[model samples]
Target: MAEVRDGYKITELGEIPLEWDVVQQGDISVFYNGRAYKQTEFKNSGTPIIRIQNLTGIKEPVYSDLILEEQKYANPGDLLYAWSATFGPYIWNGPRSIFHYHIWRIEINEKILDKLFYYYRLDFVSRELQGKKNGFSFVHITKSLMESHKIALPPLKEQQKIAEILSSVDTQIEQTEQLIEKTKELKKGLMQQLLTKGIGHTEFKQSELGEIPVTWGVASFEELGVFFKGKGIAKKDLSELGEPCILYGQLYTTYKEVIKEIVYRTDIKVKNPVIGYANDLLIPSSGETAIDIATSAALMVDCVLIGGDINLFRPNQSIDSRFVSFQLNSTRKEDLAKLAQGSSVYHLYAPSLSGFKILIAPLEEQQKIASILSTVDAEIASYEQEKAKYEELKKGLMQQLLTGKIRVKVDA
Candidate 1:
């Protein structure tokens, strides 16, 4: 690694060129806090209210009757900082909305700094804070702590240059992600065609799952498999090691469609613990949402302990478990959702799921379909690696360019 350049000096914010200044965050921008908006104040049509959840995911802004001055509202492309319960910096890209109490609308003196540069720097700080968050699900990042941290400020021209260099890498990542999504879509289409019609088939047969090749057959969960329920263990009972166990939450969050490797285990011992069989389809019986309850994965290992709220299906007939696992997650997702019942805490009954329709192909054809999809997955994995490479490069450049350890030339 290159040592700090000759013109740079050591400072609280680390090495920077002599021309740059180390300034506290408070001195540069105002962290204007947002007001508390009441739930009853929500309306059908009014000024849109932006909550932390909306900024984080697919949530759309809710309309609010409460109105604030233009300065209090954030428009598209504004920098937003969330301090409590998921602290991070977000570049607001949606329509105008009122910022919630936990968020701040940062107002910077444009002449003294580059806004995009500050956004990236604060984001870097947030990531560092993640390790220090301890076991808390939510940790508040205080204004006092933020205001005390030092930031290295360069000339306005150089700040812009650094932002440009980093932003270019971000653009490349975005384009690669788009390609990955398109490839995944192509794979999905191929699955729908290949899994049903299959290759080199002439005769067709109509079933509950629509027309499939004559060689293909239709089977219910009960006809092809058996359902087994596991005993429940409290969250406190979980440990890093003892005996390998599968958790329902892990099914929703961690496991792949066809899970060949088990990562979680139970520290507690139970009398006659239910053991999962090889090639068993594992589904979470309880979840917060319908889509979550629809989550399923296949266990490739046998004799592993299964925890409560997990539904396991062990196929009796000769079949490819990987192909069935992919089928349930893709084509049968909607069918399972229709079987799911409830407003919250969506539930999937084992019996109801047992009767669910499943398309079956010859064992050889099933293996072929699984093999093709696996190849596409490998391609997506390669693109993910490319994305990671650019991201790591960007992180290194940010540490160097933001502090002027490596200086950027400004146009005359």
Candidate 2:
């Protein structure tokens, strides 16, 4: 029922170039199921057992003293697919390990298909098949289902070219991620020093918050701010076009240490609706956990509607709002977390927040610290955007190159 484009033909895997062949994934490769291990077989040290968690890097590797058939083991560089609760294709970069039963060791026939190309093909297929199978216990894709999956294959050389292009994009994404991590580490080190020690200070004095700069002052949070509770707006009341708003939940899910721009809006009407002021520190009054209850962000804009379950702190003229937000999120997080109380769902009240103590720097010093941290945050955001752009580029290339919608140059 679909029209075939010129120079393309209709096939079981859909329309592909005239020179390409429609092949069952199993036809060009062999799938070897790994051995399932018994509890007693696990040991303190020997051969590592690769579980689904090991492949995903969620848990540490468990070792086994028992030896099994050679087919049960996967060595470095072997392409593998985890088809259990977590589904994806992985090229093993770890030591030689016996893979669990849930994983399939794919051995490609390289004469007709390049191994790297098949790896990319399997990755594409796995992503498509993920979460679509309805009746399974937990995305339990069987080996037969994977083997029987249909795919369009181009010439071996063309496959290699497609794989090379995708791999280059992947490398860029990896490097960008590394830069993001390094910048975060730098922020952590700077916060630890700046909050406690004043810049270029030689004298130090003991305070309730440990040793601080001699000239710095200490005060309870209530001394510097007025607490107000946001009223009325609920999740269902939010809409696409209306007055800009900040919800309590967004404090944890959306905004960070500082709120730059509002993403949510609502048209709902309420009596005595609360509006946030610039430099107001926002904290979620209720959350699923104590750590979540402690999360806070400073509103940088004026006149936005503030929803329920959020506590707003309006600082005095002398204090910097970003400085207070960074201090609470970094240096004072554990202390603030302890104030949160509840058995199931935690709640942090304005009264508890008011009594919390903080070290105060001169207005000029506070602004300087905030400026340095904000610049680092901007750098991280730029790298994140670059990473996302490359990922999108790879996704588009896969859709085009894999199906021969766009062909790569090959030697005669």
Best candidate, TM-score-wise? 2
lDDT of 1 by residue, 324-374 (tens): 888878888877888888896788989889888788888888889888887
Which residue pairs clash within candidate 1? none
C-alpha positional error of residue 49 in candidate 1 after TM-score superposition, expressed in Å: 3.3
Pairs in clash, predicted candidate 2: none
Global lDDT of each model?
0.83, 0.89
lDDT of 2 at 252: 85
lDDT of 2: 0.89
Q: In model 2, how many backbone clashes occur?
A: 0
Instruction: Please give, for residues 1-412, the per-residue lDDT of candidate 2 as tens digits.
Output: 8687898998777778998999898899999998888899888899999999888876688899887889999999999988888877899999999989999998988899998898888878876775365534465888888888889999888998899999999999999999999999998998999988968889999999999998898988799979999999999999999999999989988888988899999998878988998899998999999987877898899999999999989999989889989998999998999999997999999999899998899999999988888998899889999999999999898888988889888878
TM-score of 2: 0.94
Each candidate: RMSD: 4.4, 2.1
